[model samples]
Target: MFEVLPHLAPDPILGLSAAYREDTNPNKIDLGVGVYKDEQGNTPILSSVAKAQKMLLETETSKTYITPQGNQGFIDGMLSLLLGKSSPVLLSDRVAAVQAPGGCGALRILSELLVRCNDNAKVWVSDPTWANHIPLIGSAGLKIEKYPYFDKATASIRFDAMMETLRQVEKGDVVLLHGCCHNPTGADLTNAQWDEVLEVAKEREFLPFIDVAYLGFGEGLDEDAYGLRLLIENLPEVIVAASCSKNFGLYRERVGLAAIITEDSKTRNIAQAQIQSIARGIYSMPPSYGGALVDIILADEALNNEWVSEVNDMRERMKTLRAMLVKNLHENGSPKDFSFVNDQKGMFSFLCITPEQVREVREKHSVYFVDSSRVNIAGINQQNVETLAKALVSVL
Candidate 1:
């Protein structure tokens, strides 16, 4: 059996990360991974998380397994964070939430839940969605399809095409949407565009499955959640997968939430039972540390304020970095205009360069980017922005 197994290629992003680590170039820049990095080229833990950990360390007493749904405080806090504190859904007690290992786990668990709901459940994702989505959802035995999303030519959302494709989605099918800070292409839908998508979703009668991994990275918390809230408000049913990896700097801790909004309280309770049963079959229970930390931070007044401030700082830094890169590219006399980078939100954007050009930049300039030319805006710093700009210009 072992001898019959075939070799597999490494994941593209991880492969790029390994290559970057091994490169001897002193000025090498890594823009491959999706994690947030500060000006010092480090993924710093938020001060609020540090404080929360200290508090937990000092006062916490138990190491036993948590409930199948994990910490209730964490579930409530995440619900408030995703929806508003006074959201009608929460007040009506129509939402069911469960903690998962991380965003990916939340997605997979939710996908499995969909399978339980409908044997032939099909999930439609963006054409250029995060690569892991394919395996994470598909491995659970759900059929996957793609709809047009980002257009490289204009460096913007292909809204019309996306809407047209989604129009064909049949009832009971699930559509996976990035809640905010769209991965890979950072281009987000405007409020008007979101309204259009909502109209289509309503007409199609398909369930909306939203993945919200980078909530605070796009804009303010509420601003970033606008589209998600819109769908939840209008639709009788919605599914949300949220992560604390980016906002809480809990990457290693692997904290995430899977929420289901149902048509009524009875349905919500049933969904909760089903989701808890699914969690029991998957990881048994989510790790307690990360969820506990998030609960502590959200429950405390000062720490909550501090965490929001820290998230704002990170968002502003990414915005500044986007502007800085575009400025550098213009000053370097690049034949192309990167002004669209400034208009986009969050940690990533496409350079819109070819795969060959991507390889050339990596081989010749020691600047690493994924094949699609998506770069993490957080990877650029004041020290290396000019160098990166020059390298990009040379490749062009």
Candidate 2:
């Protein structure tokens, strides 16, 4: 019976990691994965997290399972941190949150809830969103539609085309929006464009499903969440899948949360109950470590400040790398203008290289990037930037 089980396709990003591992080339550079690496080429644990772990070790605590809804304080702190207390949704008692395994877990559970609730509901995602978005949501038996987003010509967001596509959306449609630092394509909507999106959502009565994986990496904590905050102000029911992987560097710990915004406490409670049920059928409960670490950091004033500053440092460092790459690429006699890369945000940038060029970089230059040219800018550290730049020049 087990043998009858069909073969499975490998995850694109994960597969890349596996392939990179087996490669014989010693000089191969891997920019395929989304993990952050410092200038020394290390994904170090932040000092704030170290302190949190130390405090946890000293304190007497039970290893018993946390609640299905997760640590109450984590939920509260995460909600407040992601969406401030004074935000319209929270102020109206319209928000409900539950801890999930990770952003992927949150997305899966949310997809199950939405599709199970209404099979007719359509989820619209950007044409070139995170590749996993399709399989995760589709596994819930819901079909996804594509909205115009990336404009290769300008290497920027086609806001006009995006708005036009969304204008036709009706009430009850689930539009999966990246909160900040859009994956695959670093191009994102501006604050003014977010306002326009909210206006359209309001007019069309569409529900907003926000995925915020790279919150602090884009602009800053409060700044990255600006679009999400605006959505809550306009929409009554919004679904959010927030990830601690990028911001807190907790990818391996699998930390994330799913939230819903509704009109009243009664509805919020009902939605929360459903979320818990869904979580139980899935992972039963989230891992305690990452969530606990985040909770400890957020709850402590000094530690929170330290974590914020560290994140800011990481953001700035990525910005510096982007500027350097753009500058160096332009000066290297390459005809292609890579200046657009500087204007992009977050850790990942679409190098705009074709599949052929991508393959050439990997084979000849030993530079690894996704076929779509989505490369993690963080992977190019100080030691390897020039090497990567020269390799990129060779490929281009």
Least well predicted 10-residue stretch by lDDT in candidate 2: 85-94
RMSD of each: 0.9, 1.2
Go through the candidates in order and give each one's C-alpha lDDT.
0.93, 0.88
Measured against the true structure, the TM-scores of the candidates, in listed sequence, are 0.99, 0.97
Which pairs clash in model 1?
Answer: none
Residue-level error in angstroms, candidate 1, position 274: 1.4
Q: For all candidates, what are the clash counts? A: 0, 0
Candidate 2 lDDT by residue in tens digits, 310-351: 999999999999988887787776678998988899988898
**Predicted candidate 2, C-alpha RMSD:** 1.2
